[model samples]
Target: MGKSEAQTLLEKADKKANSSGGWFSSSTTKYEEAGDMYQQAGNAFKIDKLFKEAGDAFAREAECREKCKEVNEAANAWWNASKAYKRGYPDLAVQALSQTITALTRAGRFRQAADREKEIAQIHLQETNDLRKACESFERAADWYAQEDATATANACFKDAADLHADLEEYAIAIERYEQVADHSLTSNLTKYSVKDYWLKAGLCALALDVVTAKRNMGKYASQDVTFPSTREAKFINALVEACETGDVEAFTGAVVEFDQVTKLDNWKTNMLLKIKRGIQTESIL
Candidate 1:
């Protein structure tokens, strides 16, 4: 064979020799020959120290090293740390995660090592129940990923912060996050149970009933509801029981007005009105 073709064959053989243990055996250390080849390559590249070439060689060597006990410990340590963080142990989790990051760095996954560092910070801020700090960390994470134009990852962090804030009953913050979710227009992609849509409809039904029954702050309620009323709004009906019992003058006039307003928004007015009459009759019995 020609010199270049012979060299290509050697490289392929070198690659094949180094990749041992089929990826499933943690204790299988039978790839010493492959590991030696990797070490030779790394040393050869180290002489030049061209950053790209060194990095590539390091990656290949790291991959060539079988699933040694140290690598397993590193992965396990990180996994346990993640579990601990989830269970509310920030200090311990960060310590373990730090070790994992070190191990991964040594394994030549520099970027992943950096990501784990950020993850450690996030756990301390969020999983430790520090919402403010968590928000900061999440923003940092979003910024880091955004700088790389990783919109999906950035949004995921934002979404996590939003959910965390919501869990803490920070509705305003939650609303902001919800707005971010809307910004992605994920609704177009989602075809699941649609709990949000259901809740929106329920909210509209409740608001309409509140206005027709009490009439206090009805205009503001109407205005707000008008802008963002739900799809199931026309399918919902208010029984108007309290209004009937109290002989609310507001209900008598306001009910028809709101009903007309709701009807104008949809063609399902008759179905809604019938449902309301049925609801009223049910209330009459109770």
Candidate 2:
């Protein structure tokens, strides 16, 4: 088949780039010109539905800008590459985003790198539907934000990972991440009030596993936060733990009902507790 217009343009751009001192030693204007040609080729490829080629061209444009020390422009070009790859090649999209993140970080743009990390986590969660990968990515993003002293943002990312782990029924991992959220929140005056809620979530996740784990976590929470005091939430968790220890389905239901009457359980918590109740009943039968 004859070369398509996009392919022809890309070949011409490559030849021009090679003749003009190549990628490594090209003048800034020469690199810019090459980058523009590559970008044009990428757009033409997109119109032809040559998605992988489009992505490659955009990535090449990004590389040229990166060599020129145009960090922001390179980051944008990488982002475009990711967008181009998203439709037919999700893994490539992720790779492109990773490059963007590395470029931004190398330029000492920590905040932007943190944001890009979060975007990568979101892509793992929403596009790839890989909960474990999403959790891992979120944890990395949280660490980056924490390094920058963005405690609230870090806590939020940790919470998101914890929630995803909970959905995966990885209760222990969920509990650990939730505790991290609580621990971080307690250290910041602005987020102190939310600590109890995170601890409550951690306690609930532990309760889903076993009463002993829940109790152990309760003690740990008390030790970690000296200000931890008994509240209705604490009482509710304690009651559930006691009921779970005894395999008392009735008592478990009663405790959940009582708590629901006051501070209503969300749908997810309600479903998890109901499943636990069923498990207890089944065990009693056996």
Per-candidate Cα lDDT values, in order, are 0.48, 0.85
- The TM-score of candidate 2 is 0.80
Give the clashing residue pairs of candidate 1, or none. Answer: 18-34
Displacement of the residue 254 alpha carbon in candidate 1, Å: 21
Residue 144 in model 2: lDDT: 88
C-alpha positional error of residue 144 in candidate 1 after TM-score superposition, expressed in Å: 2.3
Please give, for residues 135-245, the per-residue lDDT of candidate 2 as tens digits: 888988898898898888988998999988888899999898988788777777888888887888888888778878889888887887766757777788888888888
- How many clashing residue pairs are found in candidate 2? 0
Model 1: C-alpha RMSD to truth?
Answer: 15.9
Give the root-mean-square deviation of each candidate in angstroms. 15.9, 3.8
lDDT of 2 at 180: 79
- What C-alpha lDDT does candidate 2 achieve relative to the native structure? 0.85
After TM-score superposition, the amount by which residue 19's alpha carbon in candidate 1 deviates from its true location, in angstroms, is: 35
